[model samples]
Target: MDENNNLTEPNDSQRNFILAIYILFALSVVFTSVTSAVGAILAYRKRDDVRGTIYETHIAYLLRTFIIALIGIILGIILSAIGFGLIIIVLVEIWYLFRVVVGIVKFAKKQPVTPTGYFM
Candidate 1:
């Protein structure tokens, strides 16, 4: 019984580390560059841990999202010449946001987030 209780209680550092990851994820959307950079650093530093894999996945997601956004921008510019720019941009942003949110949630929960529905 005592052993069980001890097992359930995380030490201070572990608790703080878990909270830090959550906070970093929460701030990622608003301050992506900084938050993601910090996440990447932490991920590299803790490469042997399970949490490190999550952070690494997150970093990959961030980079891919930016690449997708760039593609959207270029497409938007080309489409604007044909008068469908606004619609395409809106759709792309929505898609990008969805991928980021879903991927992060799945990572946090230790589930596999498959690339699907235009995510490549």
Candidate 2:
């Protein structure tokens, strides 16, 4: 019984981490840069815990999404000085929404995100 409980604890913690990722992603849509950064940090901190498990893919997906989004935002800001960043920022926002929605859907269905080697 004690062994069974020990096994379940890790599963529960993993599930909580997954849930936290989803919530942070959702919050990022509303709070923008702040929550997105927080989400990325959370994923980074929890990465080791999920290694070799299904959630590892999620961490990778989220980490990549966060990095790309940050880059896009920075580029957008820089280009805005030249009047091109508005479009880039808008596109990046859409991409963020799409990634979050897809991630949530896959998570809901309890399926692993297929490794695409790039942002999906």
Candidate 3:
């Protein structure tokens, strides 16, 4: 409550950021890798602004997801030369999609992500 005893609502910027992240993730699933990179960059840029807030966990979750997906895809490509990379690539893609969908669902429900581990 402010001096007027009115309840102060949360700012819209946080919600905007969350929605942007979800859109970017969905784009990544439908389009190319560029969207994922953009999302990761946005998360990094906004990390400080959300620090010490609940949104910070979401930011961290996104960063970890992006980095892990990138690394896994690269490794999958390299290992494909050995005939085993095909499996790795498929698994990595599935994992990435699962994380994005789960995150979006949780965010939409206004629920805090439990565990918040490196993985989904």
Model 2 is weakest, by summed lDDT over 10 consecutive residues, at 1-10
Question: lDDT tens string, model 3, 21-91?
Answer: 87897798889989989998999998887655556666777888888889999999999999999899899
Question: For candidate 2, lDDT tens digit of each residue in 67-88?
Answer: 8888998999999999999999
lDDT of 1 by residue, 9-42 (tens): 3345543453465456456556664564464456
The per-residue C-alpha lDDT of model 1 at residue 39 equals: 49
RMSD to native for every prediction? 7.9, 5.7, 5.4
Order of candidate numbers by lDDT, starting with the best:
2, 3, 1
Point out the higher-scoring one by lDDT: 1 or 2. Answer: 2
lDDT of each: 0.54, 0.78, 0.76
TM-scores for all predictions: 0.50, 0.85, 0.85
Give the worst 10-residue stretch by lDDT in candidate 3: 1-10
Model number with the top lDDT: 2
- Compute the lDDT of residue 110 as modeled in candidate 3: 54
Clashes of each: 0, 0, 0
